[model samples]
Target: MRDPVLKHRARGMRMVPTDAERHLWQYLRNGQLGGWRFRRQHPIPPYILDFVCLEVCLAVEVDGGQHADSGYDEARTAFLKSRGWRVLRFWNNDVLRNPEGVAASVLEALGGVRRADTCPHPDPPPLGGGGN
Candidate 1:
């Protein structure tokens, strides 16, 4: 069970997303990615995931350089895996630099299927002129 404090923290996090998380959430929210619904800042047991496609038990984490050598993240990955969730981590720069690639990777993880680099967003809204 998710503790109350953790749940509260998760709620707050959803409101104050980091730059990378904000960018990533645009693709994830509103089922824009092939109808694959994703939740942001979802609390699970003892942790909060950046994005989770619960339908496929997949969690995507966008981490900054600070996390590159953190053992805590390693432990978190292991814990999530032990609970039957597949985890994916992308560097903040990578996500911001190439969200399409991140989207491609997420697609692969969700269904073991791959899309070409130009996999367009389903029911795409005006994306402010070609910037992901």
Candidate 2:
């Protein structure tokens, strides 16, 4: 179960996204990036992801100078990875100055592959294969 406080915090963050976050969101929202849907300010326990495609288990984070060389980020990434998520981090300047490039990198990581471990549903049985 998710903490209610964290869920509320994530909702509040969505209401006041930073410039870089807003910029990246344009590229990520509505399945604009290679048909992958991304949710901003999504709560995933212990942390709120800046953006996440839950279907593919991909997390995209945009950071400012304050996050440079931060140990907290390293541990956070490890935790997400342990939960079967693949995290991609970008600097605010990079996203603001070259939004296209940042988006391209994210698309490349998506690569049209959905990991079974991360997919929400198991593969369904083939039609007409299973006996009644």
Candidate 3:
């Protein structure tokens, strides 16, 4: 149920990313951050996430001054949350000037768990018929 138009737009966005996006991509690409794969300019239908880790259902957004107090962004965040995605937002300046801090926050939201070692479900049901 993917939207083709949004997918095309996302592809175009990836071709010419903003300065902050470009810089942040260096840290997020190729499982560089926490060994978790992140897709840049990823489409989630009706919106394009700046970056998303599908494994953890986490979305990261970097915003410029134009987004200050934006009603649209608020709505978008609400929608994404309703769909079970954890959203983290950072100012463009912060990403450019303090990437380490931003990355730390993202990692913290990710529960500081490395992707390969982390289990999707921490507790599993026992396999046998109990006390038969």
Candidate 4:
């Protein structure tokens, strides 16, 4: 269970996402990409993640130009990483202009299963079917 205060704040954050967040959410929302459900502006105590795919233990942050060399973001990344969550950061323009590339990178990070219907190849026909 999450704290009520944090949950409230996360809800507000969801309602007022940045344009870059909105753009990226288009691909991340509703399990659209890789069938991985992502929560936006999700709070994980002490910090709010821009987008999180809990199934893969991955957190993604979308940053504006002001975030260049931001120590705060660095600390947040460290904290999340310490908790066994991999962090991925993308610039605002990056998500806005190149959403496909962003989604592809995310899929790669999640081990690249494009959709539920598509899957990695299974082992081939047991080589020779045990026949002489």
Candidate 5:
């Protein structure tokens, strides 16, 4: 179930994500990131994340000038990290200017945990009838 507060916040204001966000979304929207689906403006627990890859517990934030407030960003990052989520931030310009680099970095981070299943070994058998 989704958090009520998050749902309220989401409904309160439509966040017109920047150009960088749109660009990144193009790559991430359709399971383009190694077939991992990503959500935009996702609310995770108590916080609203810019983008989230639930499959890998990855969060991406595109920051504009307002994020210069070090204290706030630090606190947010700390909170997310504490929740077992890895957060990655990128300047809006960086993403707008070079989305490929951003994609590469995200892919690299995903590398460590890109197995078929994050669960421990002793893999389960294929669902339904195997070989087609």
Candidate 6:
């Protein structure tokens, strides 16, 4: 039962993640979202998430035309909620038009985890070279 439902959704999700999903995926795919690694098209309990950060119990869904089926989407969300996952949905247009805002929203939803700094630190001198 669960397998079929998941498989069905997986197929639909794969048809082509909307432009927004792709845009968001750029940040999420490489741990760019709040420095936490996120998986795209991840399979959770009874559903496949558009993006998920397992450590934070967060799932981001990029909704497209088919999402007009509110009834089914609601049921899916309810199931995910029951499993302790927080789901965030964004329309495809929203993402495409505001990728930065979308990324900010995702980061905000992640409780503001710190991102790594890019500057390199100077190496300490060898122990022998240091004065005792």
Best by TM-score: 2
Leading candidate by lDDT:
2
Candidate 6 per-residue lDDT over residues 34-118, each given as its tens digit = 5688877766645677887777677899898888868989998887777666789988888888988988898888775434332
- Per residue, candidate 2 scores C-alpha lDDT tens digits across 22-110 of 99999999999988889999888779999998888889999999998999999999988886788999999999999999999999998
Error of 5 at 49 (Å): 0.5
Give residue 88's error in model 5 in angstroms. 0.6
TM-score of 3: 0.83
In candidate 6, which residue pairs clash?
Answer: none
**Superposed Cα deviation of residue 10, candidate 4 (Å):** 0.9
What ordering of candidates by lDDT runs from best to worst?
Answer: 2, 3, 4, 1, 5, 6
lDDT of 5 by residue, 1-132 (tens): 346778678445336767888898888888898887888887665677778787767889999988987788899899877767789999999999999999889888888886443322112346775765
- The models' CA-based lDDT, in order, is 0.81, 0.88, 0.83, 0.82, 0.77, 0.74
TM-score order of candidates, top first = 2, 3, 1, 4, 5, 6
TM-scores vs. true structure, each candidate: 0.81, 0.86, 0.83, 0.81, 0.78, 0.71
**Residue 52: error of model 5 in Å?**
0.5
Candidate 1 ranges with C-alpha deviation above 4 Å: 113-132
Q: What's the CA error at residue 83 for candidate 2, in Å?
A: 1.1
Q: Which residue runs does candidate 5 get wrong by more than 4 Å?
A: 11-15, 115-132
lDDT of 3 by residue, 1-132 (tens): 447799899999999999999988888899887787889998887899999888877899999999999999999999888776778999999999999888888878877544552223212335674454
Which candidate, 2 or 5, would have the higher lDDT against the true structure? 2
Per-residue lDDT of 38-80 in model 4, one digit per residue for the tens?
9898778778889988776788999999999999998988977
**Cα shift from native, residue 117, model 5 (Å):** 7.0
